[model samples]
Target: MPDLSHPAAHRPGHGDPDWAAMRRILVVRPDNVGDVLMTGPVFRALRAAAPRAALDLLASPAGAAAASLLPQVDGVVTASVSWQQLDLVPGSDPDAELVGDLAARGYDAAIVLTSFSQSPWPAAEVARRAGVPVRVGLSKEFGGGLLTHWVPSPPDEEHQVDRMLGLLAAVGVPSRGIALEVRVPDDAATPLAVVGERYAVVAPGASCPSRRWPAERFAAVVRALAGDGLTVVVSGTERESDLVHAVAGDVGVPLAGGLGLADLASLLAGAEVVVANNSGGVHLADAVGAPVVELFAGTETVDQYRPRTTRAEVLTRPVSCAPCRQLVCPFGQECLAISPDEVVAAARRLRAVHV
Candidate 1:
């Protein structure tokens, strides 16, 4: 696919210098919230290496909110480019103004983060046009002379958090840690007081339908968990209210729209165990140090995208058509054919790990 209407015209390769020499750094991850959250370790390494330098993020609207939760970030600039977002309308060159604006800032170096499925060259072009001295990211095809530091991000990935940390390794800055992190705002209130103390939070929403398990199966898990004497809380964005309501039923507390992203995180932080689809909730729970049982949809390989936290378990039924990564499943969704009993058992295993 063509990338953001910008050709790889800029020449690549630059001499590496100590982290102390770079003044202002711009990090770009133009995707959803979970993708941005995965980059937290990269931002932390950059901050620890150059404490005096300003660190800025160029993110989509969804990514900027998640990026803000990382304390290491100094500023956020939201721009939805053609390559990163599926819904947005694009111009002749959607990145022209952004490139000019970024250039005016005189950032010393720019690091563009892209998924294995996406190309970093689009963002790299923006950095090059902005006159950034050094640019970095992974390359599958030839670099097209658009990157200064080329980091290797495998097509079928490893843990996303560690993969992001690998980008820092390209710059000679040692990675601090591989743990995924999110700074839940102190002002986050308890939106669902009914959840009380020890409860299992069930997040049923995934960004794409293919990544989500069947709603009926999730409801069954909630009922089974409740039967085990554990209180259940169902969480989702407003868009998934119907799905949340159906899953919550009369037994679980539906915390849809009642909680902001930070508030939802607080709820997850307090949970004894988080039962959710393989989505942002998994990452959020991991960030808050809560164990999670992921109802994974095997639309893609689990090896690369599974929960990055220590205490987590994934439940998926393998199929030949899996790892197709289709938004709309053409093969009857064999990945989510797992039973409710299996999910409850997976949750039990993850809980045992924490105990």
Candidate 2:
């Protein structure tokens, strides 16, 4: 039988950096909100380990908002490249501007974080060009000498939050607690009037279309949740309003437009349960300590993206073509084959457990 298990972190470095001497640090995680959120504990660990040092986050626009909400983060710089996410058209090259910004900041050391399947070299290359002498990242097959230390990462199946903390651990920064955290900034008041005191939030939009379950199924879930004496609210980015509306149908309350990132964080914090696709909402809900009913479509392995909360109930159907890593699913998309009934059941169970 094939051995299916988690991989351990491996370190291939000559010496550990002097954390005491490192004053200014840059954390490069130029992906989406979910990616940045998973890196939150790393930011916290760095602050705890180096209380005197200045920390700045280098992130994509999708990630910048969440980065600002982490109390450990001193500043956030936004730069989204074509390589970061799907549906972004060509010529999205913002590397030159990003590199100039990093070079100007004079970061003493830079740590490039990425998902298991992603290469950290591109961001690490920027750090190298910025004259950051101490660069750290996970070892990759085609790293191009972008990293000074190639640390061993845990198995690809591990939660992204734990994996990020593992990267810091390789450099001798132990984790405080492997929990996802987001500071609810006071500026984002709850979008209350329409929402009940206790409610379930359903986020039905994903950056990649293939990652979403069928819209009608999401509608069925919201309608069912409402029928079961739960107040259901549907949400997403302003760009996702159409998709969110399609999924909400008529039963769920639609707050899909106009809520800013911190506002969304506030909304999630007050939620009883978050029902969402395997998108940024999963990570956001986890960060807010909300129970998640995750309808995880296996465009990638659940190990990389599942919300890091025991309060979560993840529903997925594994297939050989899963972890296809393709933005567009070419297969029958059996990964999204889970029934709405399963999602509803999982939601009720998680809501009950968390309550």
Candidate 3:
């Protein structure tokens, strides 16, 4: 029942800024590629409502790649802010460097986007320190005056796409719809040479261990898809080469490593169907309008992460500890114990509907 009521209903001070007058805007989404892709609608709305303004993205390294595919984004500034999980330390004072870079960009306004588990205040503070006067963010906790326009966070059960659109609506920027979009840059040629003209993609890797489906199960799905007269390709990051290999087996082509974001977008865009775990691949496939069959884990609410596209089907089992939000599942990942048969069926069902 919790909803993103209105910013006016919760905002402490200052009226809505003149979005039209703003020349440069900074959108902060310092998260994974999936999270950035999920915010595509926000970027879309901003671009439509303020077409004259330059929309820039402040993102992590992984997120920067996704931002580049968004036509709405005029520029992308990559950094690992203090609030984010630091995989590798870039410099001694990365935070200061980020603030300085943002200040130099002369962003007239800033919009901070975050998942339910993350706090927007940290990113909002970066905007404030960078002299971005018009800062907007959604927060369940007090922002301590960091945000110029603060909208209350929506409920946990709210779909992430809807939640972000609601945040924009609260600040006078209406949604252009919840469709996720990614463009294949001219440089990233379609990778159809690696696989047949008609192929299915099996992306079997996730950043979190809890969110991954069993490699053997993915291998089973690959075999099933191959039997259905579709060429199967298993895709993953360079680090996940072993996992991708295990899932590909003999039936599927292993396309681990060395794929840029735009290239991956092109590959998924050409897929007949994409089967993936709850990872960036799911979002990428959805963004490219590829039908997806997702083996979703219970670490997060299914409603929160499920693809917005009706062309997708998500499979999950109920568990008491679901929505645990754990990087590592203490429970044996019982929530993701879906069989390959169900996944194969879902894939066929989606393809039938679309075809």
Clashes of 2: 3
Give candidate 3 regions above 4 Å deviation.
1-9, 86-94
Please provide the root mean square deviation of candidate 3 (C-alpha atoms, Å).
2.6
Report the C-alpha lDDT of model 1 over 201-299, residue by residue, as the tens digit.
Answer: 999899888888888988999998888777899988888899999999989888777677788788888887898877777887878889988877877
**lDDT, each prediction:** 0.80, 0.81, 0.87
Q: Name the lDDT of candidate 1.
A: 0.80
> Each candidate: how many clashes?
0, 3, 0
Give the per-residue lDDT of model 2 (tens digit) for 105-170: 888889888788887777778788788988888754646467777775567788777788888887
- TM-score for each candidate, following the candidate numbering: 0.91, 0.90, 0.94
How should the candidates be ordered by lDDT, best one leading?
Answer: 3, 2, 1
- Top candidate on lDDT is 3
